[model samples]
Target: MIRTVEVREARELLDHLLPLIASPWLYVVVFAIVAIDGFIPAMPSDPVVIGLAALSASGPPDVVMLAAVVITGGLAGDRVAYLLGRTAGHRVRNPKLVMAKQKAERALRRHGGGAILVGRFLPYGRTATAMTAGSAGLPPSRFTLHTTLAAVAWATYAIGLGRLGGETFARSPLLGAAFGIALGMVIGGAYTLVERRRAKTAAEEPEPELVASGRR
Candidate 1:
């Protein structure tokens, strides 16, 4: 009974909050949040996007537009990072970014295309991979192609999740947003853990050495 009452209250609260944020300005906000998050991983872009998507799922907002905005924003930010990396090269001074760059380079070397795709799902991984690819002098055409695909896939996954969650709790946008955000975080966290383990295992393996053959 208490659970039902709480859900009812939350739904009433969301009904009041939705109209204010569900305007044309919402798309602009989504774009800015996603683009900025690409450069600054600490930003709560995922939650913002998911929350907006949940709202859209429940009412007048266009989910497709939301997805498109996020994809464009993400790609634009990634391109900016890539250009910076290309221009700055190995002279990056920030220790944290430097480490991320190095890890991205190694992942690219070992995994090639897969690394770019997988990196999109992780918070810091996307920026690091794009920047590292640029710094490593990867061809612009190749990087664009790979990153575009990754962005599309990532955007679709996030938007779809929000839509599903919202539809499930159509009466309560708050519940929908919470569920969607939590699920996205869980998926991202699991992927990051797996990637880290794989990277560690790879690092521990020794490289094969070439042996020259001689006539006996």
Candidate 2:
């Protein structure tokens, strides 16, 4: 009897929470979080988007709007970071920022297109890449194009994963959220590991004569 009561209470709480999660304002909130996250890596923008996307399964949330908002927010935030780096010039002294800049430069040097695309999935990777590109005086056209593509791809992946989780566990949104979070973490960890390995390998390898000649 106690277990039954507890289950009922939990369901009631979820029921109440679903409406808020599905509210139109939820898109606005998600936009704000994602935008802020670009400048501040500590923000939980990804998880929030995933959870709300799960809640959207049982509500009238507009998935298209959600995706659009997320993409817009991410791009906005990245732009801000880029501008800050551009304005800072060369006097940047923060050790952490310096490290981020180095990582960004290495990724850019080694991967080029892949760096901008894959960096979106890694923690702090996107910010580092954007800032580094700005500091390096990358052409505005090139930066805009790559960042836009990356943002769209990231939004699609995040929202699609959430929807899949929501559909799989429709009866319990909490379960769906948990599943989505777990799946995201797994994917992120695996991607990070692969990228690190690839970077290490690239570091150990020597450039071909033709590539060296092109640089000269």
Strongest candidate by lDDT: 2
Q: Weakest 10 consecutive residues, lDDT, candidate 1?
A: 207-216
Per-residue error for 41 in candidate 1, Å, reads 2.2
State every prediction's TM-score relative to the real structure: 0.81, 0.80
Give candidate 2 regions above 4 Å deviation: 1-19, 89-97, 206-216
CA RMSD per model (angstroms): 8.4, 7.7
- Candidate 2: lDDT over CA atoms? 0.71
Candidate 1: C-alpha lDDT: 0.70
- List the global CA lDDT of all models: 0.70, 0.71
Give the Å shift of residue 105 in candidate 2.
0.6
Model 1: per-residue lDDT, tens digit, 67-103?
8899999898788878877887477666766677777
The TM-score that candidate 2 achieves is: 0.80
Report the C-alpha displacement of residue 84, candidate 2, in angstroms.
1.2
